[model samples]
Target: MSDICVIIAAYNAEATIAQAVTSALAEAEVAEVVVVDDASSDATAEAALAASDGSGRLIVERQAQNGGPSAARNRAVALSQAPRIAILDADDFFLPGRFARLDPDLDLAADNIVFVTPEHAARLDPTNLPAAPREVEMLDAERFALGNLAQGVHRGELGFLKPVMSRAFLTRHGLRYDERMWLGEDFDLYMRMLLLGARFGLTRAVGYAAVQRGASLSGRHRTADLAALEACCRAHLEMPASPATQEAMRRHLRQVQAKLLLRQFLDRKAEAGLGAALGFALAPPARFLPIAKGVARDKIAALRPPAPPRAERFLLPV
Candidate 1:
């Protein structure tokens, strides 16, 4: 019997939902594919339904209201019964024989992800995957937190890696996605599971292709959403953790806070003027440095020429 149930939370993803569904259904290890349509005004649900092979493996559910990705994912999980749960974004897909690359015994398992333009992704061949076996790295809570930190243009954030999780482990720990968070929710859930001593294994084998879009949610974040993520980090810090984990958490918190501060400054500047932004930045003594550095980076970037886009990119775990 297949052990994995692939779940997708889609919103206004009619353009790519069928591709995502077909890719998941192609994997032999996937017993079922559950897609939750978050009340999209488009034909996302219809597209997903059309991709079904009529094998009863594809389950599509329409939400009563437009909930965020977290809420939609939670709903999909409730409708799935497989031992393992794999998250497949509406704009991303799994490669053929992807589940065979990971160790199923581990509590959580992930593989390398390749980023490609939608056009390139359509022609991507599964036979191009390397035949060599890859070594698996075990991740500790501290290491996981540290790897998610943003390093400017070098965005090899571990938060982007979608891992296959043991449903039993999640149920045993009483853990679910934070419904309030539309951003950083995956990272938060994975971090909490790691803190609970969940064994997370990662392999360098390429098994997933994440479509890079200019309008992706990861690229367009609201200030309020970022602030909520920062608050979540603070709450995580309050929990009991090892010295190393605590330090890593602090660093992660600082990064989130920095981003939030920068966003707030930008919003204030846009709403009022430079003077209002400066006043807001100065009101909290800690916000000045991040905002200043952010402004400097923007100014420097504006002076440089734009670079050409790439056909394919890889974001390896740091």
Candidate 2:
């Protein structure tokens, strides 16, 4: 088997599963591509199966019943034999040289596995762009979570939650994506990985490109997404973290609650929602104070001026 297995959990993804599978198979480091059809009502399974080369490099199977993305991904992992795992959405495909540049065979060094970051292609959502570029970034799970506080919102899905990790790291910690969650599942899983002592090193290699479709899950389930974010924040608050990290989670909780309440107010002018949003605004959540200080400390050593602005890449499907 190759060093890595790409686990793609798909549901009713007939139009895109083929691209996802084919691109995965093109990667030399990939042992195989496992596309788990989550009981898709359409021909997603057939499309995924058709994408297979019949050379035993791709496996397309369907769940007996519809399970969410987390369950589907876990199922694929259980069936995968490679030590490292990477997730690809059915609508997305890997970029050329994704795994080769990541150098999966390198010694784990002080970390667990080599993490490759993706540069999102702007097929539909142009606002989604890469944050880090031109360098391989590294951080512990807690530090990464705290660093995210600068964004002032729960952004678990912006490539933070998706990283190529060794299967052993997850198995050792009994880690799995949240099956019960409808939103922010990525954030919850990545946060939990940090809480369980995962040290990550990241690369800015446009590893994969996921196409955004009309009325995606985030667009369809706004309310549920907010609830999941709040739930995720609450769950993280109960875990062990530094005071700064804990406070950041608390701030994120308030932001989620505020957003949830405002959305409800807009839908139906509820007094409770208005009151809750006001309550969150009045309280101090300690936003990025500690992280900012650390950043300032690091900047003091930089003698060179900031880099000049460069053109950003935005890929669209033909």
Candidate 3:
């Protein structure tokens, strides 16, 4: 068994799966690499097999039916016997000598390493806007939590927790991606792991290259995706949390979901017409007033500073 098992979930990724698998195999700490093909219409499995060069170290499993990436991931993880597991999208690649940079003693450390793209670039948004990469040092649990909150508030990005995790820690906490969620399943898993008291470690080295293509998962948007995100937020609120922490999480979720909804509304407005988009957008909010109120109230409450003028209530136009 390898010290680490790298799992890649592929669907119609023939053009990129080979490079991704090769990168995983090149990882010094990765003893085994598994590729799960989710009934791809393309020759993704064939490409992965060819990349493995008949090496038994690489295993490919083709699902009989079409399952989502989360299901593929769960299947891959179940087949692996490694103590550590890292997931890379089929289009993404790992940096050279990346696994060598990971500390062997990391046991749920809260210091997730900074991610650098394949071009040695950093992105501030999921859209892959270029930015300078900063080295993140080790941080205590509370500090890391605060960092997550800060990032969520300022950058609209959640910085705590990641998909790459210790298998032992995952099993211990029964952490798994929500297969039902078509989008934001990773976020849900990450947040739950954090709530479960998982530790993290940070490395300045960029271990993985996240492929930023127009067709990538994060690039696509749909009404189902929006619904999934809202459901995730509701689930987070249902999780056991202190009043302050719950309020912060709820605020972050609402803002993020609102942003997504607004984006979709604008997109539809651009394509069809503003009238149609407004009707579409307003329908959900109208039917879900109580839910929207809870989210909006939490968001507004969290924005207030230690002391503020009473008139500051009007500052939030949400």
Candidate 4:
């Protein structure tokens, strides 16, 4: 258990599974690569077999029946014996030094891998690169979580974009991806980790190359997706937090519910949609205290000259 185990959940990814396996094997920090095939009715398994460099560490588990990404990943993790698990979708590959960039620092120091399309990954010249996984910055926990989930409560970005969870940490908490959820399962896992006080920081490295992107199977199930998303939001609202954080969660819930109502009208979804609409419609409005005693006093701050700009920008382009 001294090395990292790379887990890849591949489904009907015959065309890209090879590169993914190869990439994982390329990582010096990776001791083994587990590729779980979700009963693909194609050559996904065969491609994985063909792609192996015969290091005897690439374990390919081909399921008998089609289960889902969650089930596939769970199976892979169950068979692995590494302390850290780095996940890669079949259509994604680890950029060089991905494993090298990721460091172990208890619950923090996770990787900061970027998602690059197939076309995007092809233009780089291996001979003259800035070196794989160049570390750049650290991330704030709450801010990272909020920004990661900015897309939606059930969606996340950077902090969790490429999770490399500590095996001991997960096992101790009895935590695993929600197999029941067809979509937003990652969101659920991240939220649960955050609630339980998992502090995630960035390696500012371990960038990976995602060969392709498209709508997920759950994306087509708008009703189910929204329901899952709402469940995620409610879970957040129930968690202990400061007044400001709770208010932000409330505002997010309102926005989600409003959309659920409209989707219900167009898709004629189940009772869930109607319930969300009613919940938002009947919710009380929020009030905030004024910052200043006088309007003129408030305007004084706004009228002041802007602070001097720094040469270094606060945000880095992803």
Candidate 5:
């Protein structure tokens, strides 16, 4: 079987599909590249086909109907023949030596690799990037709970949103993307995989280039999306938390909820404002207080400046 199968989900990504496919094909370890077009109305399929030309390894599939990305990805993974599978959005491209950089242990076994992008790249900025240097390591149940809890709290930074996974592990755990969740599906799947005792490999290398654009799913904010994130948080919390982990989970959930609330309040859209307010009002009273406190702390943190030397601080006191 092929060492790795790269799956790309496309929907009106004509502008970048070729580059993405070409990059995937460039990876020496990637045995095949599969592009699933979710019934795009644009020339995405055509572009993918053109990119695949002369590369007999490229397989282009089209959905009969316009399903969302999660569904499209599921369809592509089901058809993938490789032992390991890497997922990339149509608008994203992998850097050279991506597969070569992955942990050899993971490369040979049924493990997952979490590849992180560079710091200044607009697509996946380092400030919001997850822990890096894709190395495989075992995780205990408690560790998994805490790790996922921390990830939920810092979802924007953990960047566990999406990563390369082993098809064998997925099959063993029956792990698949939730077709119902359009937003944060990657988070959901990753959390579930962790709960299933999947090992992790972290890499600082920017193997993938994620294009930041207005039409991206993450670019759009909706009440349903926040609700989905909250639901994902709740799911992670229910995964048998230890006492310490439980407290951590609660704190993380409160912070996440508060951030969502703030986002809702600041949203210019009237409907989103109403929804955010309603969501905040419906949250548990105990949690609301913590959420508010967390919000205030975050605001203060944002306002604070960097620390200076003691002597300099006295000499140039602000």
Candidate 6:
């Protein structure tokens, strides 16, 4: 059996920390569960510790200052001694038998995720989850980059996946989460690994439940974060890849740049005035469409009734 250490990076997650810690400890294949409280003002570290089973399998580390999720996760990885590493977000958790579904041979393995609200997650029965046929897909750098492309308001992009990775592989390649990035950090790390010849496998097994909350931290990204993501995407273009992969990188970079511009335009408008923002937005005619299109999309989306939250299990077909 492969011993896996689950790393959780938390920030003000006291209300949900215990559940995340408990669920990780429930899996027999999980040798350790490490929760790094990223300088949360709340009782997050205490809550994580209280969830320990007293078997010395849970370790809660508190950051001296808030360093974002990437830094916290990198710290957890360094502290953990397990052969395999899996990331479980403070707001998300694994279902039973999740570790058993992992492919030990692959450098990275991801499983299908079921999106649930907190209310729906609380009602889930681990032993009686909806049955889904298992399927496996091997992912290369090209496939991963292309899959991460966001199409208007789509819910499940490959970028959202959480995967288990081989610690040895990470150490051998000297790879860690880019501490500079909080947005799309997972996608950036995974793409870099794949480029380095890491074997990434995705299985259609429903063993992870990702809680979709009412107000998501992802929903509110600062302009700096978007700019960082755009820079990261640009860096990937310099790596050696097939033509298809290069094209995908170009497309993804363009998307990130567009989002960054839109964010900057909005920020300037808020800080300065509409005249200043319009001047920046329309100076380059090419920039106007992406910003205008994004604004129009959001406006239209707001007019429509919000989609009812899923009351039942809805496993994403990865």
Model with the higher TM-score, candidate 1 or 4: 1
TM-score of every candidate: 0.96, 0.72, 0.71, 0.74, 0.71, 0.96
Worst 10 residues of 3 by lDDT: 309-318
For candidate 1, lDDT tens digit of each residue in 1-318?
A: 489999999999999999999999988899989999999999999999999987799999999899798999999999999999999999998888899888899999999888888888989886875554479999988999999888765447898889999999999999999998999989999998998889999988889999888888877789978988998899888878899999999999998988888999999999999999999999977779988998898899999998765666767732
Model 4: residue 177 alpha-carbon error in angstroms:
0.4
Residues 102-127, candidate 4, lDDT per residue (tens digit)?
A: 56754534554444445656664333
Against the true structure, whose lDDT is highest? 1
Q: Which model, 1 or 4, shows the larger lDDT?
A: 1
For residues 1-318, could you state the per-residue lDDT of candidate 6 as single tens digits? Answer: 639999999999999989999999998888889899999999999999999999899999999999998999999998999999999989888888888877888999998888888898888876676566666789998888888888654455788888899999999999999999988999899988988899999888788888888667776788989988888888888888899999988988988888888899999899999999999999888899999988897789999998887765454643
Question: In terms of TM-score, which candidate is stronger, 4 or 6?
Answer: 6
Query: What global local distance difference test value does model 2 have?
Result: 0.64
Per-residue alpha-carbon lDDT of model 3 for 171-223, expressed as tens digits?
A: 98777777877666666676676666665566433444554454667557566
Give per-residue CA lDDT, model 5, range 220-271, as digits (tens). 6575676667777777778865676567556656655765665554452355
Could you tell which candidate, 2 or 3, scores higher by lDDT? 3
Model 4, TM vs. native: 0.74
Judge candidate 5 at residue 317 and give its lDDT.
9
The residue pairs found clashing in candidate 1 are none
Overall lDDT per candidate, in order of appearance: 0.90, 0.64, 0.65, 0.65, 0.64, 0.87
- Residue 128: error of model 2 in Å? 19
Q: Lowest lDDT 10-mer window, candidate 2?
A: 107-116
Model 3 clash pairs? 108-199, 108-200, 109-199, 109-200, 109-201, 110-199, 110-200, 111-200, 111-201, 111-202
Name model 3 segments beyond 4 Å from true.
Answer: 53-55, 107-163, 263-318
Model 6 earns a TM-score of 0.96
lDDT by residue for model 2 (122-211), tens: 232323344335355555545655544435232222323356776787888888887877666766777787777675655554555545
